[model samples]
Target: MKSKVIERIAAKILIEKYQLLENFYPDLLSGITDIIQKGKIASRFPYIEMKEDEISILIKAKELSELKIIELWNNQDTEEFRALCSIYFDIATLLDKDFEFKNEEEIYELIKIISFGYLGEHNHFVKNYLISKKELIENISVPEQWNSRLLVTIFKGIVCLVAKHSWKDIDNAVILINQLRKEQKDFESKFLNTVNEDSRPYGSAELVSLYHFAKTVEILGQYLLEGRVNGNEFDIENKIKYHLSVAKEFANASANIVLEMLYKYFEAFSIKLINIKTMENKVTPNQIIELINSLPDSEKHIFIENGKYWVTQEWLCGAFAGRAFVNEILEDAVQEMIDYLYKHIGHDSMVGNSVTKSGFPNLERVKQYCTPVESEQD
Candidate 1:
């Protein structure tokens, strides 16, 4: 998520979107500013009552567009999508079609926002260009390079493939999934051949997250392909079961990976902070914040800072998602690393527990099923 960009054509395009949207949506520029006084619009982040006009959001997004890629990426600013076409296409092709991109950074920024929630966005172009885009994406020179997007493409293909089978339309779903498996295999091999634990290309954590994500679906897709989607009986009852199974798997995988994609980038920062010989001790967010504040007025500012978007651990749409789930993993990951470093350096007992302090309560209260069970196997 380290972003450093001088040319932000994608940024400009997004700023321009406010202008472009007036043509179609007719709300941004000239309106009486109902958004500030409106009933409410749900947002991915915590929603707040607006005391200012709606244009302030756009105005802030404009400033956000100019920030260097690293700061922008660390923020994972939602405004990134305000310019990139979210509704226009799925994460798979959000960048496939041409844009007036001035640099690779823009493409990366576009990819970041799309990847964060790819599974949630339907590929509107699937029926028309899934195959063609597969061919085009083949030429991109690296599989891991386009990690999350590739996962989204394959997962979307799986959804389409299994959807037909779950409806007792086995003849067609089988054909479609076979083709998808073939194309996906080709794509998978290209990346798998080059990437490894050490030789990972950029966005490696996202790539790993994508790998596990695709693997989870691929397992279910295999089951569906082999007539196990609903236990081989193609009845209406079995069909519904198949669909429910796929949904269950999708929820589990989504809950697990989406935040991994967010938190993995901090691995290096965590290591460096506690690695100093004199400071061979564990640190918490509270500790780190205190240390940074203790720095001299003329000292260089620390790159690490509070996240611009609130990181939450609770997710309730399905599975164990929501802000609480996200925050728990994030806090635990941070504390674990802090503890591990302190121990590695031979420090005294210093570790922290991740408590569910706020946000939607532990989603276990709402989810009827547990995380998909893992069976011992070869």
Candidate 2:
């Protein structure tokens, strides 16, 4: 069967399953005009190709989309009702991933529905349904074998923890985090004990594990640092920040180790930045930029435009070279390194947010690259 056809059929089933189209149903003939004008629904379900009844329904959808029926659906607070709305949002978006439905109000409604479980839904029908979905998703692990298997498991675990937040208890969250921290520490301790400086450098398994550990720490750090559990801010923010800081340290260490393990394998390994100490033939930032410009468009894009670490890539490589050898050419590179640190580490820029609790220091470069928010409330 065609996947799109299956999805369309499934969408109807899901709407009925969630019982959304009933309570929030608009006039049967009301169409979502915005979807029609944008050609979103028309392209997917062409008006000419559809049966008479299907065409009527599509017209209704087009008009309802125009009238913002989704927003109206969100105003209802019942858990079953909110879940029904989520089904529509999921169906509309799944039909066209890039479609701009702008249905956050619907999503927020579902979030509210689930939030009731955190408060007092021990016997509620919605609570049981949410828990069952959570369990089903949690049970499906990626079918990978070997050392990479650990990475898959860890990744799934992280995702499950994130999803579980809506229905999980805060005390449970704290307990789970602490347990993860202990597991992480224990795993690291055992790995370190198994390998010392004289041992063979890390293999793919070790590399994967380090990456997973870093990501796990980052996720834990964001959760604990942000204090997102029930609206009440954590009673011990200091303790939480400290825990997150330790996670940050681990993530940083993992990044450094990954760089050390993989840098030589890259194609750009031949180009070395001059060391400031020995004062050799050093390249200026302009010269470096020109060299980067000389590269093929594809390589240049990877180096300077969009890939991970692209902005910091050049500076970091130069710093690495400076430490690798003692040459006079690297003197300028060293000074440039200092300049980079001074500019990024200690300054605030135009994007400074004086109101945030974290008081994150402004990064001029990050501000320069930041995407603007289209909606004011966002």
Candidate 3:
């Protein structure tokens, strides 16, 4: 009975090492037992001399690594978690061949080392580590049988997202996502066949990976659209605004600026003219100036003296000028009017100063669609 118990323990390790499942376990056990009975365990080729010191060293190293990880989590040190993940990955690689683990948990802890996004290292190491031991992962599936597929897919997606810009290499990201999608057919059979609904959260990691892959595709699509816009000379006022409004929902700050500029340019094309019937009924620029000047100095300064053009030739100038109020309250609406030209139209001949200085076109030319006199009273 004592010998039988020893055989069972040895068989467990052999099954884990070779990744043999229930069907092959008995034959694999018999083979290992023959080798042990023949005294080939220690005298054989490709042998590792397992000593008490080596045993104690691996135990201490694993314990130290686990404790450090726990400390990092408790301290909320994101960088430290990233750092130790690297250390554990190296240890897992070095121990793969000759080290004898006492049980499955130790082996599983090493596998979890790779699952924590430690894969920012070389891709070849990551790819080989995942692809080489397909059988081992299949037999030792702990979190779920399909966790290996999801983990490997996420690692590949992160690599593609970080390296690519302007839609470059998006195909690589698509390939990883496509592989995950293709696995859906077998999912019900491989996963749903044995899983009970009592543990609803059991397969959450798989769902998370699916969701993340969808987001990655959306982000990549935004970059691609931006690149297309940059290459083409579409009507900036009309076409670009529509594209960028959608893009801004997905992109970061740099892309947001692009969207804002496009909106401003489009607004320049759409001016609201101040309609006056005839000279009797008309409020000409001069009349508007006189009316502005007749008020008290504080009020006069707000409109005419400042060379404020409330009318945009193409769109309502007051509307675009008013955006500065978002940052501060404008107590002096006239000084606000004075600074408006300096803000939108520059001292230089080229109009729409902000967009022009930013290297966007003089889109104010499109403002010819509406009539606004842009001149100061002498």
Output the number of the lDDT-best candidate. 3
TM-score head-to-head 1 vs 2, winner: 1
lDDT, candidates in the order shown? 0.35, 0.35, 0.38
TM-score of 3: 0.30
lDDT of 3 by residue, 70-131 (tens): 45654433544544444445444545654233243444343344433232232345445655
The CA lDDT at 197 in model 3 is: 71
TM-score against truth, every candidate: 0.25, 0.23, 0.30
For each of the candidates, the C-alpha root-mean-square deviation to the true structure, in angstroms, is 23.4, 24.9, 25.3
Candidate 1's TM-score: 0.25
Give one digit per residue, the lDDT tens place, for model 1 in 280-376: 3323333332332343431222222354212221221222322211122333433343343333232232211122121111223212221334698
- After TM-score superposition, the amount by which residue 304's alpha carbon in candidate 3 deviates from its true location, in angstroms, is 63
- Please identify which of the two predictions, 2 or 3, would achieve the higher TM-score against the true structure: 3
Clash statistics: count for each candidate: 17, 25, 5
Any idea what lDDT model 2 has? 0.35
